[model samples]
Target: MTDHVDVLIVGAGLSGIGAAHHIQAALPERTYAILEARDAIGGTWDLFRYPGVRSDSDMHTLGYRFRPWTQAKAIADGPSILRYIRDTATEAGIDRHIRFGHRVVRAEWSSENARWTVEAVHDGKPVHLAASFLYVCSGYYRYDAGHTPHFPGIERFGGTLVHPQHWPADLDYTGKQVVVIGSGATAVTIVPAMADRAAHVTMLQRSPTYIASLPAEDPIANRLRRLVGVRRAYPITRWKNVALSTLIYQLSRRRPQVMKSMIRKGAVQQLPPGYDIDTHFTPRYQPWDQRLCVAPDGDLFTAIRNGRASVVTDHITEFSETGLRLESGAELEADIVITATGLRLLAFGGIQLTVDGRDITPPETMAYKGMMLSGVPNFAFTIGYTNASWTLKADLVSEYVVRLLRHLDTHGYDQCVPTNADPGLTEQPLLDFQAGYVLRSIDEFPKAGSRAPWRLGMSYAHDVLKLRYGRVDDGVLRCQRRPTRDAAIPAES
Candidate 1:
């Protein structure tokens, strides 16, 4: 069956949900649909269920501005955040408009018709839908069959192997030796939580990572939240966390040695008496160089102090019958193994997009304000940087897209395409940071040349001002008139 809509939004996660809210609020008369690949609503939250899974940023900023975060502690866990997203979708009436089990595989833009033809699989059958505009909210390729890196002789290992992305609820870790591989946020979280229930937990990392610890609960903030509404308290709470986060980021950037010393001090306070912070906590790269791991309640550091957990700094040469054999000739035994090796991101629902039959190569395209891509008309994709909350930027982008759509509706135009004037522009990196996901996917993404709109800025303050209140005359967007034959052609008065 074929369906038609004014706008087709892909993915029902934070970004997609945000987009839907803005579009419906701004244009109540216009009809739109959010196509979700999965049966559930929360995208990443629904996908990752590993122990200690949670947001790295504070909830005040991570949550939507329209819906203030009411939680006392700014940092939140997976279940709470998931509930927030699901609740937001329900309250916004977004759930009624979604078509689940519909995995979009491709989208082709027709210049002749000035519409997008999207193809998806529903119930093992292909379905086509057309829309005047398309909005992509599918996050970076973080989910796809959880990544399980193969160590030599892994199949021969006697222990159970799992990836954090696909962690099982029934799997028991009580009194078992658990070894988690990878040093990102997921690994750091798993170590602490597992150490509580397991016989022992060991985190194996080839290199150290910059980890900062904080209390699980904030008392004064909680008091203020109770005294005032969350909306009233949200700004202060968000800024407070932002200020602290920013100060540490700047300290790490300017005074590397000082930041290193401070981090080591925290580690020393929470680790064993003779524990060497330099060997396990001192990262070779600058702090925030890669995303810094955050541990609330100081769980990771607590495990180390209590000697319930330990860190191994060496490459895995192979997997033995019951454990891993390190490249340094040391073998560590474990009853269970988890590969938190990270995620592989897919762009545009892993679908191949084309304009009038010509394929659009995402890596070769230019991202304008980190949202709109050159030559793509009335389309925007939400992608957040390693520094801030993913939802904050997504919410702002949603507002901007809605505004752009409103402008087009009033202007008697059916199309607003962002075409790079200089087709000969060479490709360059979007972000120069050392984030593992960004690093691995950089070569496969659209490059921002040295120019406005085309360049991607990681700063939230800059983007919020530019995107939320910026002008449309920027060289990137090209507003065009509707064709004479279209059904919505403006009346010639």
Candidate 2:
């Protein structure tokens, strides 16, 4: 017999926990359970254990709206974030509702029963469960493997090679030369962190990424907390961060040159005067074309200034026995090399979906409001903003889902599916970001329309208006109730 639930949430991470909280608060009567693939909570935070693993976005906005972050540091480390998540679950009694090691592999929807039959693996056995609605919080990338490009002669490298995604617990780099490949957030973070112990660290990149230095602690936030208290200051700080992030993003798009100059100037202020800013600090792409890499308290630049680390901008020709050899005839000798390449994006947790015996291909389908897929009934997924704090959008998605579920119950509807009504609407890529991870897997995900509702504006203000307060009975959504036995029988007439 299949165990049934009102809502079956896949993944017990940040988004999943938040979703559960909203459901419990808004629709307490509904029965729901979270299925986590891993044995622990904190999803990304728990998985990543590399040196200096900290959030790129500030905690004020990254933290859930319901629970305000009281920590002193706005940019928190992995352990702190993990503690925050676990504490929230424990306090809310949400820990009991999670089923660990249940990795959902397939989901089938039946129109007749108005339910989703989900199949997962647990302890090397198949487990079956049913739910009226399926909430996917599994996130956008695959956990099993990260995206690693094939480097010629990589097998010849004699030293330790590591990827930040799966950092080994027993690995040690103390008093050794370390070369971190790529200029993404992870690379920038690990360079400074590993520099503390490693004799020297070098960041090798083909092209540069926009790097910004933000204070670890916000003076304004601290002052506000002292005056108005943590609870009262949270919203104020969150709004301030959101507004600032939004303004910078908008300006980067509108006035690229001005923003580029400002970013360049900031980088120069942090580094030594003779440092090669053009070679190591400048990016060919416009600001925000790819997500900007943030260094708390300019740690990366400080390491460079102190001669503990340095940056080399050159393409890797091949990997020699010692380390990487560049196309410019320069070779970096290292005892350890770390690949901070990127992630492999996974849609719907790589779960197979079928509707009424028809296989649903994600790329062929359209994403409705960046949450639900067109023609997918009683289902919603969370994908956060690329330009701002992820939780800013995730919170809105959770609230919207709760509102939608309540609407269905109140109206006696068994199923509510968003159908793409406009056939003439042109399809656009759902994620507009040019990050390598996104670009590599964008085609595997669903498409969004070029117009409203179907198109995700990626703007928090616009989403607030459309998702939070938007009508549930909009014509684009088709709501239906299963026919009762008596109603199914033809009228006597």
Candidate 3:
């Protein structure tokens, strides 16, 4: 099947939906197609289904500016969030434009035609699409497959193995001992939820992660949302939430002892051992250096404090039938094992782009405000940070992309590529923090220069100011004539 559109959007998640909304609203006449890999929509939100999965970031910044979340819960669970994505897509009429089963295998740029030839598979059938511009909203990496350590006897274990990403909805764990591996957010979320029904839950971690337990719902904020629309109320709500979060984060940084004390209280309540608190509750790094996992209503910590769950801070030696063997020769038996390892990050499908047959290595290319790749014409990607909600950055990037598209259309120009080639330029990591995802995919992902049009800013206010209202003629973007063949669609497949 051969389809032609002015724009091709991959991934029907928050960013892709936002991009479609902007395009449909600003340029209704322009034709576009959204190609999603999954059979259904909602990228990451739809993918993860661990026991107590919810947003760590508040809904104010997590939601789109165009669409405000009216729910009373500031921190919502997975189902509600997925519904919100679906509702937004439907409300904006973006759902109908999506090709749900389409997965893009590879996309190659044709300099002669000044267009991208996107090749994808739709329901076991080949589909070809060509677009004047390509907007990639596919998320940073593969869905969390719950990193399973290669325990020596894992294959022989009698218990069921589960990764948070592929959790079975109907799997019963009640009255069964469960061992959850890894101290990441997914593992933390699963421990408490499983503790409610399981006979016992044990959390195993090599090193502790900084965890903050807070209320599930904010009373005053919920009231404000109910009284005023999300758009009008969001400012106060976001600022208030961010301010409090920032304060706690600062306290955890400046006074780890205080934070540590608070954590001990929460942990000892559930588990009666004084030594256990030091083992699983104490992290190696300062708070907020990595992401701080949030358990709404303090459920995870509360469960620990009440003796419903136990934490073991030790490396695993290997798997044993009906249980796990620790490095200290200790065996913990469980009916089910959940691996909450982390996700593997991939940048642009690890695709190597050659503009005019020149390799456009991501690290060598400048990221124009973390959206538009410098030297690539009419292309943008949606990337968020560990600090803020993914959509906050994505919404701004979507708007900027639409703005750039409109500017090109109005000026009667096409083929907008950044050709500023400085061979002597050095590349560096966008964020200073040491995150596995960022570090692993840094080379594959486009590099952000230390200055404007190359630097990646995680701040929402700064991005809004730059991407929303920044002048088009910033001397970084080079817009020129659309090749004569660009208007002509590729030959039918």
Candidate 4:
């Protein structure tokens, strides 16, 4: 017999855990199960175990809205964040509802029965699960491998090469010269993180990225928590950070030169005198065109000033036996090369989705409210914001899912599908990000619309009103009643 539930959540990460908590709190009677492909609870936190692995976003906004981050460190390490997520699950007994080692391969939606028949592989055995709704919390990136561009003559290099995603546990780099490729968050994090042990670390980037320095600990947030306690202070601090970040993004977009000058000034103040700020720090694109990389307490700058780390702005010629050859004919010797390139985008955990017998192609479908797809029924997925903290958008998406579920039950409907009836709705890329990883695979993802409900809301303040307080039956999402069959919605997984 196939297992069944009211909702089947396809991940155990922060989004999935938060989604579960909202469902349990709002609709106590509804049954749900979280199917985790990995053996652990913390999804991205668990998968990423490389040294110096930490969140780019601050803990206050990255942490769940319901849970206050009690730790002093605002820019938290990976293990700490993992502990927070696992602890959240354990405290709520959400751990009991997770089915680990279950990798969902495909999902078949049946309109006749108003259910989704999920196919998964668990311990080399096939397992079938039926649910009224499918919630995909599996993140947008390929967990197996990060994006690694082919370096010419890489095979000729005698030194050890490693990707940040699959960092070897026993790989030694003591007193060894290390060269990290790419100027994204991972590259910045790895440079200072490995600088202390390595002889020297060089960050080689094709072009500079917008990097901003933030304090490792937020003194204001800590002070507020101490004075008023976590319950009262969390939301206040959360909103404060949200507003500040939005204002900065707006300023960057509005007055690009002013923002550029300010950022350049900050880099100049932190770096050594006569440093090439224009060549090594300044980015060609406007800030927020790609994600702004964060360097906590100016750690990366400190590393550079101390001569433990350095940045090289140039194109790669090829990999040499000793090190990498630059287009400028300068050769940097390295004992180890770590490719901190980027991630490969994966949609719906790379699961094949079919509506009845017909296949659902993501490129053809349009995103409705940044959560549900326009032609898909009883489905939702979480894709976080590029501008601000990921959890801010994640929390909003989770709350909105609860609202969708409530509407289905309260109105005596089995399914709901968002249909694009507006002829004027112009299709745009789902994510406007220009990162190499995004640009490489954006065509595989769904499209966003030109207007409301169909447009992607990158702003948190706007999403709060639209998602949290917006009307559910807006005539676009058609909730329909099906012939009531013997619905076998189980109470638990």
lDDT, model 3, position 457:
84
Off by over 4 Å in 2: 483-493
Candidate 4 per-residue lDDT, tens place, 111-183, comes to 8898999999999998999999999999899888889888999999999999999999998999999999989
Clash pairs (backbone) in predicted model 2: none
lDDT of 3 by residue, 340-409 (tens): 7767777765445556656677766777777777767778888886666788788888888888888887
List per-prediction Cα lDDT, in the order shown. Answer: 0.83, 0.91, 0.77, 0.92
Worst 10 residues of 3 by lDDT: 484-493
lDDT of 3 at 319: 87
Clashing pairs in 3: 269-305, 269-306, 270-304, 270-305, 270-306, 270-307, 375-418, 377-416, 449-454
On residues 153-226, what C-alpha lDDT tens digit does candidate 1 reach at each position?
Answer: 99998988998888888999999999999999999988988898999999999999988887766665687788
User: TM-scores across all candidates?
Assistant: 0.95, 0.98, 0.90, 0.97
The lowest-lDDT stretch of 10 consecutive residues in candidate 1 is 484-493
What's the TM for model 2? 0.98
Candidate 4: deviation at residue 296, Å? 0.3
